[model samples]
Target: MKRPQTVRSRGQRAGLDLDQIVETAQSFEVEDLTMQSLAKAMQVDRKALNYYVKDREALLTILAHKAFADEFSPDAIRAAEDWRDASRIYASSFVERALSLGKLSEHLWFGEPLTTWSLEANESLFARFFEAGFTDEAATRLVTMLSTLCLGHARDVIQATGSMEKPRPKALRAALERLNPEKFANLLRILDHGYDTYGDEQIDFSIDVFLVGAEAVLKRDLRR
Candidate 1:
């Protein structure tokens, strides 16, 4: 049997080799990722860093790609039994991965024009939905919805926690208490148990709603 050839990534081919840079950058807060700081950490001249990344925006794009690539694998989606399963896996994996990244998640949330690998990975994932009977337009919309849901949740969690590693129950309770009890009664009641306690529940609720709507759309499309 012949062995398959291994393909090198663009960074490796160009001597840009961004793995070290990405790893180092992830350790710092998103606000602190200036080119000079990254170059200093990498032991390269600031000007030389441009040889690999071109600019801060490019570096951020590469970092976003690295983070997503670590969490999402094309083969995993391919191995799923159905489009629904693939989407659930994608959303869950993406949210978990983004959360785990700490401050690094900001790049994934804000970066535009994702790297080639990231784009290709997303295309493959969405293509599975199309193959599963959804029209091209429907698949595109569904993908957008799912991605937005996950990213939005991640952003909310980040804001809620601020620089803290976890949500502070005391702080949340105090904030809720400060609101007018009569007008915000429902809001306070919902968060009485603490906002952090509902993270998993909220994620489940959002995913359930999305999947339900998606199924309805798919059924309607099929009937036409």
Candidate 2:
């Protein structure tokens, strides 16, 4: 495999350049890498790297964009045509991807500085949800809730149990099953009638509840 070299000639001379730094950062990530080690491997002076990037934070953002841009698979999410269905697919796919990447996923998604590209992708996903009849506020809240739930659950499962490789698809399927519209309606019924539910006593389930409530609210307003 030909290792891609960062362009370092002619038009740019910003001390190893952003491309080289980003490429080096990505290579480091692939090799279970670190920034200190990246500096060593790239053979660029630390001061030069400091001059090129603000700090490790900048380097990490570049690496995350590269990783997501190159490696993230949207096959699962793309299969669902409806916005609600797509949200389920997206959550599961993201969790699976995070599990595959292990610590790298955490570093990419949660580590500091953050990637604008990843943030924009998230914003776009929620925007799609809004376009599909959900209000902007509802869409944002729902996306935030689901993202936190799924990503945190994935991190817990993978990091603590070391079960990173998409543990029996059924696992994620079961989680998504909770978000079915009918099931959601049932929860609303329980809440309306003042009944308590058992198991998974966390805010993770709140998104499903909120989705149901939001849909009902929208329908009511539209009818009025």
Candidate 3:
């Protein structure tokens, strides 16, 4: 077997631009991507990709950073009218982006390399909460709660829709019908009304509930 020549520069190689690899990987579900596969798509040998990315983990980390930075941009949060608005915008955007990434959402949420950057971005958003009269403790707790809510909702959306693809209405209805009504009365009732899909409405509801609760707590604390 002949050895493949390494591309020395970060310019275009085999139709793959070094700069576009991360964005290209974002087009596929995280689990579906690998250096070998991506290189194949780029019409380059896998070794050629090494010139740009060291390995799969590094590639994934880059994608995670891009996704997080885009959604959690400090400027976007700063432009919000208030802490509540900032929280709403951040949570909604984060959930939607994560959901779009499918299995890759796990890497973004739990990956260790991105932790410092995540915390720094979140801290910027937390400052908005503090500026809105929330004590440090209150602001931290509220931001933590909102993050948990958004992550949980994103996970639910992934599982419900089966990997960011469109919902299989027939398959979903069949699964719901298989559950015993006696044990899952509420679920059955929900399915009966054709509310088989979890979507933006659920995300909005969770955010609204959290914001309302946070407001009540802040008001009570102010009164004390």
Candidate 4:
């Protein structure tokens, strides 16, 4: 009887592809993810990883871009009822997507030559803003400010809560207790209803405040 040829395992050697490496790497927590760690996960020698990706920087860049492209809708801005509503939708969606990445959010850098999906979303936003009477420069600044705010806010939340949903502030509450009641009375008062901490609601609060200021600016420009 003729026997079938022995098959080799995909993880047994350097017979690997970039997509395979990236897909496997995505399963690991960002902090624990490294070239060596990924290699270990694949059951291949670490050098095998280098053959596919030049180094860790190249690999991480690919990962960061992939994460953004996968999570965000390129037409999200166009789905809103109005230009102002678009800002709210985009800002809130951006923050939520970043938050969902957990510690991986820290590596979410948009390098030069942005992805097509990213550019598509920004283009929609710009068109919406222009139609709403904003100059190119004004629209650019508005988008930049809103995006910066969302990224910074998401980073702060991730650092404090480590992406824990509904995180309890046991440590923070205890630390607040140690402060002198006279000097920190107001701070302690928040502990009664629970510590006043970052949450998803801030996204709306920030966007609303931003829109108020933007409306003022637009009205002032029109009066000129």
Query: Which number leads on lDDT?
Result: 4
Best-matching candidate per TM-score: 1
For candidate 3, lDDT tens digit of each residue in 7-64? 5554344456646787677777777899988877766788777776889988887777
Clashes of each: 0, 0, 0, 0
Cα deviation of 22, candidate 1, in Å: 4.7
Over the full model, what C-alpha lDDT does candidate 3 score relative to the true structure?
A: 0.73
Write one digit per residue (lDDT tens) for candidate 4, span 28-146. Answer: 87767889999999888887777667677777766776786676775768978888988887887788888887667776766445355367667888889888888777888888888
Q: What lDDT is reached at residue 74 by model 2?
A: 51
Q: Residue-wise lDDT of candidate 2 within 42-74, one digit each (tens)?
A: 775566667666666566656655565454445
Q: What TM-score would each prediction reach against the true structure?
A: 0.71, 0.59, 0.63, 0.69
Steric clash count of candidate 1: 0
The whole-model lDDT of each prediction reads 0.73, 0.58, 0.73, 0.76
Error of 3 at 120 (Å): 5.5
lDDT of 1 by residue, 81-191 (tens): 888788878888778767776566666753354555566547777878888799989988888888888877876686667444345555656776777678877776766
lDDT of 1 at 69: 66
Ranking by lDDT: 4, 3, 1, 2
**Collision pairs in model 3:** none
| 1 or 2, greater by TM-score | 1
> Model 4: clashing residue pairs?
none
